[model samples]
Target chain A: MVAKTRGMKIVHSIEVLQHMLNRDERIGRTVGFVPTMGFLHEGHLALVEQARTQNDLVVMSIFVNPAQFGPGEDFEAYPRDIERDSRLAAEAGVDVLFMPTPEEMYPQDGGIRILPGPQATALCGASRPGHFDGVLKVILKLFNIVDPDRAYFGMKDAQQLAIIETFVRDYNLRTAIVRVPTVREPDGLAKSSRNVNLSEKEREEAPVIQQALQKGAALFHTGASAEQVEKEVAQYITEHSSGRIDYVSLLAYPELTTSSETSREWILACAVKFEKTRLIDNSILSVFSKEFPTQ
Target chain B: MVAKTRGMKIVHSIEVLQHMLNRDERIGRTVGFVPTMGFLHEGHLALVEQARTQNDLVVMSIFVNPAQFGPGEDFEAYPRDIERDSRLAAEAGVDVLFMPTPEEMYPQDGGIRILPGPQATALCGASRPGHFDGVLKVILKLFNIVDPDRAYFGMKDAQQLAIIETFVRDYNLRTAIVRVPTVREPDGLAKSSRNVNLSEKEREEAPVIQQALQKGAALFHTGASAEQVEKEVAQYITEHSSGRIDYVSLLAYPELTTSSETSREWILACAVKFEKTRLIDNSILSVFSKEFPTQ
Candidate 1:
């Protein structure tokens, strides 16, 4: 079935999506894709906007991929609002919206698994095992179904961005991964689907995750050891917010390795669990640099 | 480095192969690919020949893919003669022969793995755990680099072909999988790279594997149960050849699932160990059919 509004087409089947994309390719149209677990926010729109500006066609897929969520994680509790998401996507100039069911996305018991190497061992990956593997699985399927020239991802999930980039490079995928900076609120809280789960006070306190990471970034620029920066960030978050520290880690930026060296790029990343939600934020900085590159 | 002979281009790197294929695609040429572990035989040549006839360009990859080999499973002793393979490829009308070194193919510790499901629980997968996972890893890399419109596989690797088909369908890969029949020697032995490891006496006995499979197929047509077919095949191999029975099994075709009923198509397959080599063969048969489908 196809639903249309403001000339934007919403498709729910892989066959229909591929049929449309095949026609687009035959006519020499370049596609830019943005994949999301649907709950419309400014951060996702930013990715859509980039896709719109860069290609002849912009395709966005809203799939709450269950494969990526671990047991006791937020798979069931994850927010999904297709109606709002479609409206936001149409407003952002998305040409086609692919909203596939879990059954449609995974029709069989797929024996193949796309696992992360050591690069996934730290940061968010350290806490969320098989999370990036599920991410890579859905992303790979989306890339194939859409056959996009380029795909868009947000820097909010910095570890995910790194893993996807590595997956693309290692697999020799034709789709170029375009990283969009994390979108934030006036109070500097990173926009996320899970933000809706936060209580009013927790929402007010969530911005401290970012604040703590900035402090860690500053410490890193002063040539702080990775361990020291992590400790300082953890202490800051514990002291400043009504949130428990999940993890605060400063490691080699994309490689996500634990090294004592302060000679290269580093990612100051943290996760804090409020009463109802866990929020993650990160800042990438080069050694001795005054600026937070991702902030 | 590019080595050319009789219009066949031999490429040693992924970048160079992609560059050449990109040029060909820009001008709108359909590519057909055959990926093989080298030491070419009539079976590989047959795949290349089909690719030649079907597409404007034919690409063949000869990578032994160490990942697919288990410990003590001939990773080091696996045969390789690229010079001879290239000559055969040229004679068989191959357009590009891609031969990459192990280091070039692996490059890094790839965290990604492609696994098999229940379909791989029997046959070759039962005897060799993680074998198909390694096969998929290399095949995916090759498919990405080649980006062929159609990729060819032999039915001699019936289980592998089935798993790859499932992978393609599950992932929605753009490439079409072309199944080529298994090529065989005059005595009905399936041509294999490991056939070289067989002694002269073992070589003479290898064809009995195929013969026992045919006999099993005949038993299956007489409304025999899967268990009965398997028992008869095992007995025949043990009685006729000096080879030891590795396994003799009957399973639902492609799915490789066991069922007591004999109403549909089934694969009667067997493996035998003769001194230095293990040989496998199979025949697909419908219930009460008088013919061995693959023979």
Candidate 2:
């Protein structure tokens, strides 16, 4: 169904989204895509803002992809507010809001999976198995349907940004993956859909996720070993937050592997369980690449 | 380097191919692609022919992807005759020959892998581990480089054709996968580049591969169970050929999974090892889909 707002067109089916994209392509319009799982956080908005700045038409997809959620995970409880999300998207300069049903995304026989490679095996991958595969599969579906010139993702999920970059490079997927810096609050907590799941007490403690990463980034900048940076982040999270620690990892940036490359950046990432909610955050541990040639 | 003959233009880089394809797209030209490893056979020509007929511009890529071969496999020994292949492709009505080096296809820091799921775990996938993953990875690279409206592949490698279809469906790949029928010699031997590796004795007996598939298809048409069809095919290959049997599998078409849908076709496939060389063949076992309701 085609539902219209002041600036944004809300499209529900893949057929309609593809049609709109095809017409846009024909008319020489550069479409930018921002894919999200509803909730409409500042991190997602930052992605949309980047998309809007870079392209003629900005398309946002708000589907809580079930394929990305693990068994016993919060797929059922995953926060979704389409009405609020649509209004936020419209206000944020999104041209088309694609909200597809799971059936529309999946086929009848069984669902499709975009299995991740070596890059998807570390950090969050360990605790949340098959999470990235499901993410990549649905994102690929969105990319094909929207056929955007550029797709935006927050670097908050630095591993995700890296995996998406690798997927685009590996699969020769045409979309340019644009990474927006992680959007955070004044206290430095990373904006997330799961943030809503945090209790008031957990919310106050969750900034420790970001504080730990910032601390690790500071340590990495001081020429500490990746192992040392990871240990300090883990220790800080365990001590400061009222949360059970899941993982504290330092990885080769974007590759998300334990391996290191001398001339590249690393990501210091951590995930912690805040009561029933899990919060994650990361920072560029170091910039030894050409981006920081002076370093 | 640009090599030209009549309507055929041969380009040596992915950049040039993409540029040409983009220019073609800008002018509203439809592109159809056929990707093959060099040592062009009648089967490859059939793919090119289909591609040429279906689209305004037909691009044929000849790169014997090293990624698809296992450690001891024929990556080094895989046949290559660029002059012969180029001539064949041009004669087959190919508009562009996008031949690239192996280095161009793979990255230095470990290449991209399109890992196959349940559909890839059976048939040839069992004997040749990581083969379909490589096939899909390269094909995806080619699809990205070419950006074809439709890409042609032969059903002789039914597993490959099925996997590609599944890949396209799974990944939401933009290019349509066109399956050409298995092309065979007068005696029913399916054309293959590796046929050169077959000994004269093996060559004579290789037709049994297709003959067995023909027998299997005949049995399948008679309402035989998938298991029975596989058994007869395996028995015929074992009895007649000098080759050691790798596998004789019959599974749901375009899925290659054992789980079948009522409105789907099955594929009877077999692979045999003739000394160091391997040969494969298949037939559409049955069709009960709505598309073939009369059948």
Candidate 3:
């Protein structure tokens, strides 16, 4: 009963989650989900808040899935603070916190592949081999566990967002996928739990990543071609920032295809390495030709 | 209303399936799913029968997924008779026959990869690059689509069944996975629709594939080592059978690992190519020793 008011329920097992979810005899209660690898940040909170505002019950999962991490890719170093995450989640008005341990999540002899398609091969997909697979797999597991009416993801990982969208469409998952705008700091640095790992200097240089993306967006708005936009952004970041540019490309929005002729809306997405930490950000640019005749 | 009696519902979209499932509000309606590439045969029917007996609803999907087949493989020539499949499904008491097209399954921008683990790298996985990935992708899609309470798979495709079981466990999917015994013909040939394409001599020699597996099982029954059993079976198939011996080995049941000593329970599995048609089969052997101690 106390859980109903605060909308709080903590479920670790898939069976228990399904059992509790079945209590909703009527379809009136809309379930919202926010899946994270714990070590929650303001960006995660933004997603939770969005879910809380839109849905009746919010389920947040804190799982640092190993499958998504490639060999020697910081599976162990990936931050986890469940007590703090739970407190933050409760404050964010999450109805349930589905925190399952790695063993609980992936039982012995467990093997399932949730491969995100071609969208996986590009962007982060190219950087991390099994990363998107892990992302899709864990999210899918959570999706089944929560069976949320709506699921929220951040645009901070724009390609991840795009891949998830493709998965939902391809699998025809029942959950309504909602993409909330990327949450950022006052300095325009994209909010990430990973930001905590950054030193003062790295944190200071982080905003430059956002600035480069913004500049790219501005260039696209000024009638620059995609190649020109990418080159300018890449050069600016290389000169003005200490971060190593992983990739800088202008792609068709949602589709994520690289094209120079910007006849339609597109996204300028990129990932940069500040120290050993990798940070990603993106901004959408709606391209329109000024010479178009009125229909 | 008519579909309800048969435990069948015509859900036009994934949204509708979720909406109706949401209304059920009870976790008791255990669903048993049978995913197929259509062109249903008795081998498939056996799985359906097992599902019907065990679960509340039997949902079968008819999809010839392109992702699972190799470039020069039988993707184009893969047998598909949907109209006939539907009628057979209805006769099998299938609650819902999910018929999704390639476009329906994979969106224009979709990138899916459901890779099976190391076990996938052996046997069929080694032969077909990205085959298990495609198989996994479609299976994951089906799992999301049906959200079944239980899923039934045939042991005829022993490696596939093993990989799927691995996926379900690894992902912590809630569906109760039930594997049915492999169905075979009177002559010990594994029932496969591909058998239709076999020439008369090839069809007659096909039973030798199963015979070879049985020989291994018999060797285990006679207290032979796994290595000896595997060697004998491989030799028997190679020497006697007209088909090209793809693989013949004695493995631990469920685990699919090669063992030196024979245990009470082991699987004798093999794959053989009789011309263009590939046949696979396995039999479980229960080994007993005269010096065994009582529990």
DockQ of each: 0.52, 0.40, 0.44
Of candidates 2 and 1, the better by TM-score: 1
Q: For model 2, name the residue pairs that clash.
A: none
| Error at A77, model 3, angstroms | 5.7
lDDT of 1 by residue, B14-131 (tens): 9999989873254557899999998999999999889989998899999888899888787888888877988999999999999999888888764767777887778878889989
Writing each residue's lDDT as its tens digit, candidate 2 over B91-139 gives 8899898888877766543333457777778888887888887887788
For candidate 1, report its TM-score: 0.93
DockQ, cand. 3: 0.44
TM-score on alpha carbons, each prediction: 0.93, 0.90, 0.85
* 10 residues in a row with least lDDT, candidate 3 chain B: B286-295
Chain A: TM-score in each candidate? 0.94, 0.93, 0.91
RMSD of 3: 4.7
Docking class of 2: acceptable
Supply candidate 3's per-residue lDDT for B138. Answer: 79
Candidate 1 local accuracy as lDDT?
0.83
